[model samples]
Target: MNANDNIKIDDLKKPYFVWFEENWVHDDVLHHHQKGQLVYVESGFQYITIDEKIYLLPQNHAVWIPPNAVHKTNSHSEKIKLMIMFADIRTKNSFYHKINVFSVPPVLKEMIKYAEKWSKQMTPDHDENLFLKALFNELPRFVEHSLTLHISLPKDQRLTKVIEHLHHHYRDEIKMDDLSDTALLSFRTLERIFKKETGLTLSKYQQMLRIIKSLELLSAGHLTISETAYEVGYKSVQAYTRSFLSVMQFRPTDFIKTIQ
Candidate 1:
C-alpha cells in the first residue's frame, strides 16, 4: 500500500502523516489538499506541476508543496523511490506557504529516513509526532539553499509553440532563427515577448532545461560526462560543467558522488 491507498491523508485528524514507497514510474492527476506536503526524492526524479509551471525534483532533493496548492506529479524513471509526508497547516510557519526545492542535508536526510519506521498518522504529543514536529521545524534553516528551476508555461500560443519545440529538441543547437520560425514571429519580437512571458531570455531558459535534463541523465548513471553534455546540447564538457555548476553549485562528477 502507498500514500494513495485506502487512507486519505487529508481526512486524518492527526497532525502529521508519513509514507514510504519504492516502485515504478507513477503519475498523479491534478489535485490539491488542505495539508502541506514534503516529498523527498530517494531515487530517480519527479516532475511536479503547480500554477501551470513544472519543477524538476532530482535525486537527493526534496520539494515542499504548500497547502491548497493545485498540483500534479509524474516520474519517468524506471525505478521510483520516495518518502512523502503531509503535515497540518496550522503551524503558522510562513516557510510552508510556498513551493520550494532544496537539497536534503545529511542531518535531515537521516531524520527523514528514520521516519519511515512509523509510516502512520501521528497525533499531537505522541513520540512520533514530536519527532515529526522537530523535523518540520528544522526545514526552515535550509530554506536559503532552495533551488528555483521551475519552467513557466507561457500564455501566448506562439510562445507555447516555441517552448514545446525546445522541450523536444533541447539536444539540438537551437538558434533564434529556428525558434522564430517555430513561433511564426520575428527574432526580435520573439525574444522580447518570450522574456516578457517567462521572465527569462530564450537562451537562458533553454540552458535551464538542459541542466535539469542533465540531472536525470547523471542520476541514471548510463552516460559519461561528455556524452551527457552532448545529449543536452552542450558541445563541450567544459561548457556543460560550467552550466551545471552555475545552476547546481556542483560539478557533474561531484553530483554523481553525492547521490551515490
Candidate 2:
C-alpha cells in the first residue's frame, strides 16, 4: 500500500525548507511535474510512477523524476523524505536516466542536506553559490540497485509455475502451502529457493510486488486508497501506510505532489 502523490513546493529558484510528514490511507490521481526532482527516502517505502511504469523503492534509495510525466504514488506508511526541485538541466550531467537508487555514502547525504539548507538560506554571497556549484559538479555517478534485493528461485520448472502464480495473484492473500503445491516443491525447498533467487522472503517479496503494482495503479489514477490496499493484498489501509513509510518515509500525498 502507499500514500497519495501531491507535492506543494515553495520555489525552485529559491532555497527552501522541506519537512517530512506522515499520512495514512490515501489514493492519488494521475499527475506529473513541471520541474526536475531529486527524492530520497530516509525512513519508509515509496513507489514512483514514471511514464506509467511503477518502481518500488525502499529506504535509503532515491529516484529522479523529470518534468512533465503524469504519475501517481503511494506508500505503506507515512515516511520521512527529502525533495529537491531543479529549474534547469545542465549539459554537464552524469547519469543519463532519471530514476536512480543506490547506497549513498555519508558524504553525499551530508552534501545534499547541506545544499538544501544553504539554498533555503538564500544568501547573496557568491562564495555560497560557488560552493554549491562545486558540490553539484563533484557529485558522484553512482550505480542504481547497488544494494537492492535480488532473489532467484529454484531451477525446477515447477518454480516457474510458482512465479506465474505470484505474478497474477499478488492481489490475493498468499499461503506457503498453496505456493508449495503450485511449485511442486516441498515448502522447505521452496523457501530456500525463493530467498536464493529473489533475495527476499516470500512475504517480503510479496510486499515489494504490491508496492510495484501500487505505483502503476496510482499513475493511472484508477483506484482509491482502500481499493489500492485491497488490490495489492493489504488487509488494511493503515497496514499499507505503515509498510509504505518503512520504504518511502513520507506520506503518499506529499510524494504525489512532488512527482506531479
Candidate 3:
C-alpha cells in the first residue's frame, strides 16, 4: 500500500504532527510530501529509495527526510512498527534539510511512545501542547547519535542498469567485464562513473549490498551464520564475517544477539 496515495500534505494544517504505528509490509510508489518527515523503526527494517539512493533503516533507528524529497519504501519483517511525524516548512529547523539516520535514543523513543498513547486518548489541549513542546526539544538531539550509512545511487542510465543487475545477481561472482557489457560502457568509463556517482567502487558497492542483505537474513532468525554467508555470495563464513564486520562494525552473531 502507498501511504501517500490518500494523504494530501497540503490539506493538513501547518506545524502538524501525526503519529503512526503499524505491523505491515508496504511497497510504496515513488512519492513526496510538502512537509519534512521523521520515520522511526521500532522493529524490522525499512528500505527507503530517494533520488536513486537506497537507505537501509533497521530496528531502533530513525531517518529524517527533507521536505519534497521523492522517495519510496519497502518494509521487511512481520512486525514493522514505525512512527511518522511531519512538520511544515515554516516550522522546520536547520537539521531538517538533510537526510539523517540515527540511533533512536531511549528518551526520544519513550517520548514518541508517550505521544502515540496520548494522541489516542482524549487528552486536554494544554496537556497535548506540553507533549509537543517536549517532542520539539528532543528532536534536535537526534543528530548526536547519527549512523553513517548514507549511500548514494547513480544517476547515469548505464550505471543505473548495472546497479539493478547487481541487486538481482549479488549472490553470483559478477566480473567488471560483465558489468561493462551490461552497462554498454567501456571498462574505464564504467569504473569512473560508478566511483564518481556513488563514491564507491563497483566491488565495494556489491559488498555493502550483500552485507545489508545479510543483516536482514540474520535478524529474521531463520538462517545460520554459515548459511547467510553463502546466501550472500561469500565462499566461506570467515570471509563473510570479515566483510560484515567491516561494514556493520560488529559480527553477525553479535548483531543477532542484540536483536534477539
Local error of candidate 3 at 133, Å?
A: 3.0
lDDT scores in order: 0.82, 0.56, 0.75
Off by over 4 Å in 1: 1-4, 120-125
Stronger candidate by TM-score (1 vs 2):
1
lDDT of 1 by residue, 111-145 (tens): 99999987764454487789988888888896656
What is the per-residue lDDT of model 2 for residues 1-260, given as tens digits with 9 covering 90 to 100? 12453344424343222333333333556765555455555545566555645565555556655555555664443434544424334544545235454545566666666655443343344555565555544444544234232223345465688877776887788786778887778898888888776566777777767766765455344577678777788889899888766655655554444333
TM-score of 1: 0.90
Q: Cα RMSD (Å) between model 2 and the true structure? A: 12.0
Q: Evaluate model 1: give its lDDT.
A: 0.82
Q: Which of the numbered candidates is closest to the native, going by highest lDDT?
A: 1
TM-score of each: 0.90, 0.46, 0.83
Error of 2 at 188 (Å): 31
* Separate clash counts for every candidate: 0, 52, 0
lDDT computed for candidate 3: 0.75
Q: Which parts of model 2 have CA positions greater than 4 angstroms off?
A: 1-27, 85-87, 92-97, 116-128, 144-168, 171-260
